[model samples]
Target: MEEAADGDWVVRPITGAATGKTYRCPGCDQEIRPGTPHVVAWPAYVRDSDLDPWDVDSAADRRRHWHTACWRSRDRRR
Candidate 1:
């Protein structure tokens, strides 16, 4: 893991949820190139539940960004 300026160890995305899309850096408002090294906040891992179960096919773990410029490069479909 590479050490970020904010003292976070940035690691490569190991899951398919972050595979193809472009993400923006919350710190710099620059494009986070696909497959590039980035500092991602890993979410809490919860067991599958009936009320709020995880969808294996859905990109559920995709985290939100701190800035709009950090959004995916593709225009979102409503």
Candidate 2:
């Protein structure tokens, strides 16, 4: 867990098998195929004050998938 200017982030390194879902990598704007290891992350804050636990589903929507290389150097893609 770490806090930055953007927001609090819970960084998790995970194996692709665990995901059981395909996602698009925001860092590279490419498909993150299932069974391919990647990163899954979520913000550590609550967006709505009245919401419970900050709305995990909403956070998941906001969370981004990233290729390992893209995460290491996203600026290169830009």
| Candidate number achieving the greatest lDDT relative to the actual structure | 2
When summed lDDT is taken over every stretch of 10 residues in candidate 2, the lowest stretch is 49-58
lDDT of 2 by residue, 4-76 (tens): 5556767678797687788898887889888989877777765674266454555555667788777656556
After best superposition, candidate 2 residue 22: deviation in angstroms? 1.6
Give stretches of model 2 more than 4 Å off: 48-61, 74-78
Candidate 1 lDDT (Cα, 0 to 1): 0.42
Q: Provide TM-scores for the models.
A: 0.32, 0.63
Task: For candidate 1, give the lDDT of residue 1.
Answer: 40
Measured by C-alpha RMSD in angstroms, how accurate is candidate 1?
10.3
